[model samples]
Target: MSSVDKQLDELKTDVEQQIPNDITVTDVKYEGPELVLYTPDPKRFAGDGELVRKLASKFRKRITIRPDPTALTDTTTAEEKILSVIPEEARVTDLDFHHDTGEVVIEAGKPGMVIGRHGATLREITKEVGWTPEVVRTPPIESSTVSNVRNFLKQERDDRRDILERVGRQIHREQLGREEWVRISTLGCCREVGRASFVLSTADTRILIDCGDKPGAEGEVPYLQVPEALGSGANSIDAVVLTHAHLDHSALIPLLFKYGYDGPIYCTEPTRDLMGLLTLDYLDVAAKEGRAPPYESEMVREAIKHTIPIEYGDVTDIAPDIKLTFHNAGHILGSAVSHFHIGDGMYNVAFSGDIHYKDTRLFNGAVNDFPRVETLVMESTYGGRNDYQTDQADSEANLVEIINETYEKGGKIVIPAFAVGRSQEIMLVLEEAMRSGKIPSMPVHLDGMIWEATAIHTTYPEYLRDDLRDRIFHEDKNPFLADEFNHIDAGEEERQDVADGDQCIILSTSGMVTGGPIMSWLRHIGPDPDSRLVFVGYQAQGTLGRRIQTGWDEIPVPNPNDAGRTSTLSLNMDVSTVDGFSGHADREGLMNFVGTMNPRPEKVLCVHGDERSVQDLSSALYHEYNMRTFAPKNLETFRFK
Candidate 1:
């Protein structure tokens, strides 16, 4: 047998010896990066978790105790037991039994109440049914994306297990002559702020991070040239790690699956849910525009099946020589700052993915410290001189003022927000401000993909800031679902009625006014002098939002008279850009991130920002701290020792 095989056999034997003699270990297997052991009676050691915890500490690997197939009760009895054990007040919504994974997924409206104090209810169910209990939230607003991905995981159980087993064998393979130089290639989103992709490679392993497309027409936009960077086929890729689900950071991932890549995708559970919604929406938008989509929806489904949802700070083996851990990036719902531990201990690299260094209503600020970091790949979206927008308190005050002024004048405030981050933040801001009497409550409208995205956020409240989660679970107050916020129908006939009705505040998607229901709102309100159009997020270059931000009086939009034609509309409504509320750190925040690192990064690479922002941040870090820094263009490669 090979050295890896010998090691695996010895490890299993050692674990078998260490566990209780009475407990029957049905099987001890390496599932992906973690070691899982199946037991005929997991309840024998399930009283206080001491046995499992001790075994995990001894093995020095993630260990999970799963029930053997024979020990598990059938679906009928398992569901009945689960329903009986969980209290009625918990609002159990759905139950899914994943036989392949030996897990019984219990989805509830109030997941916390279902678990009971000290997780007594879950422990009882696990002991009684012999199947591990996994509790997931059923968001007040249901997302089709969440449903599809959950169903995919359930139906393709055999396929997922096979993929994980193969990946596990690959990850644990014997290291082939380590101790070498490391290289990082910026495949996309280097000098400009879209299509963020990168490749990290060593002698034996090649991994891609953030394979996304620039938000524009496929041929017209500059995107990551994956083939050029790899020089090899997609089958050679060891893994693909997503930083977040933003279209600019995840849109092109389906292309990899469509082209022949069937490797595992590493990301947080929330990121997977969001990616499904965003990627499928990308195709739908293209189809509506009478343009061919970059990839069919099936490719997206294929991508979902191969994904491995990981939590923050879980050190996992992706490549033979690479150990990867994700830290909170605080940009969107499940965005992450990837920290790669390369070789035995030769190098450590941290890639900051669109970080917001200051806490917003939805998430906390980005995490700067890591176990080890030698090179830092950072985003500089607001790194220019004088990019410090405003304090959160002052920004909240400013937003209230803008809305009150417009509302008092009998003019509706139409804010175009990005669906993922900004839409949720704006909703909370409006909800809280109204509750505190800072801004009078109006009929707040939510439309397009924003509501579905919000639903996904609710399902993964644990990924949110601690304070927000407390308010949702403990305090029984979820700001996103406040009665004042109205989800407008994503239909033409219903939306036009809102535009013609009495004035109120509307929050719609495509923050930059690039697309989605925002277009309809603008079309109806742009020519009205009394209505106000607010831009609360970044307006990308070349987008209609940026044009209006630059004082464009007339803008071309789809002609309502004919779908095939377009018309120019005069801008008569008030236009305002709130500088605060950006999901990226300013120059000061970026400096603080580097300055606070325990062992300061010796080398820093700037990315995912405009020309000025990236350059300014790189130069500042180099000159101010006397550190080695480089801001490379797309397709540029940087080497680290």
Candidate 2:
């Protein structure tokens, strides 16, 4: 027998020995780092909740209980029973049945109502209908991306199951050799701040972390041409661990699938959804700009099919020698600090992916505590000596002051923001400022993908800061659903009308003014002396936003009167940049993170910044903490063990 099959047999025998005989076990199989046991009498098995916990503890793996196909009730009857069990207040929107997993997904407006006070309703549904119940929340604002992803997953359930099975087998396969040495190769985001990727490997396993690409730069993909990055080729990569959904950290993942990479992607559930939205938007933006996208949309769909959504704090076995765990990065929704435990505690490495060590209006501070970490890789985005930002309160006050001044001037306020993190943060700030009368209430237009991105954020409230999550859970207090906020339609006429007609605030995407609706708004507002252009996020070098920040007097834009013609619009608008709204840790926060880390790391690798910033941060860390530190460039490899 194959080693994997033999190991499965042993696991099955062990489980059968522990399970009560009344609960007949039909099969035990691996399902992507989880061991799912199919039982003919799942209801009976469910009665003893402690049984599954005990099995998980004994096996040191995730355990799930599912009813055998023969044991599942008919779909029609099951739906009726589920509706009967759940309260009408739940406002169930969709009922999806997955026969392969014997799971009925119940999407409801109030998931708490569907789950009852203590999961009594859910247990009753499972007990009465012979189908495991999974509850999902319907966002207050409808998100077509969320809806489409859910529907697509349901439709492709069989294929997804097959992929999970294959992944499970690979994860459980016996190691061919002992892990003697560990090495890390920096592929990108070392000397520069985009295309963040790293290759971590041992003698027996290989893993890729954060396959990203630089935005607005053609041919700026990670150094996959390096043999160490390719290892034998794309197919040899065992898995991909995504940290967040930012285009800078997740855009080029589809290229891997296009290049014959068929492997499981481990990420938080919201990261999966948000990355899909951002990547599709990236393609749309590229096509509109007459740039050829690196990969086809089909490859993105393939990547989605292979993704395995893992919750924070869940320890998952990704390879024979490496176990992965994610912690809250606090940079954006579903951002994670990836911690890898390799070779049964032989070494531990932590990679901080765009960490925000201080709490923002959106999320809590990034997690600094880990059980063990010997080598630490961290971002140095704001780690330059002079990269200090104002306090949060001061920053918010500055923004309010800017808006009120612009309001008094009867001019529009244009704030260019990244749709995912900064846009949502600005919304909350504006919502509160207007509500408190600090800034006059006016129409707040959400253009480009900001509306859709906000919808995705609402769908995953638990990922937000504690107070924001609580406010969202209580419907009336939800800031995102405020009446003052308006989602601008895709029609150019509507956008132009908003730009020309309103003396209001506009939050638009392509934060760096590289593309998207921001460009259109700038063209209309640039020449208006009363209008103000405010930047609340980092403007990467070479972007138009940076040029404007550096006092560019005029810009060449596509002419409306003549096809394929260009015109220069004189820039007369007041320009301002608000600090302290960034999603990255400043120098002080970076230093604090290292000092406060539990059991401080033996060595540090600084990355995700310009050459000067990386070097300064590395020197500061080495001197302050007196730890071994290096600022590695792309294609640099270091052996840890």
- Using TM-score as the measure, the top candidate is 2
lDDT by residue (tens digit), candidate 1, 128-172: 888888888887677787888888888888888888888888888
Q: Please give the TM-score that candidate 2 achieves against the real structure.
A: 0.98
Q: Report clash pairs, candidate 1.
A: 417-511, 418-511
Clashes of each: 2, 0
Quality of model 1 by C-alpha lDDT: 0.83
Worst 10 residues of 1 by lDDT: 216-225
RMSD of model 2, in Å? 1.5
Q: Summarize candidate 2's per-residue lDDT along 217-241 as a digit string, tens digits.
A: 6678898877776657987789999
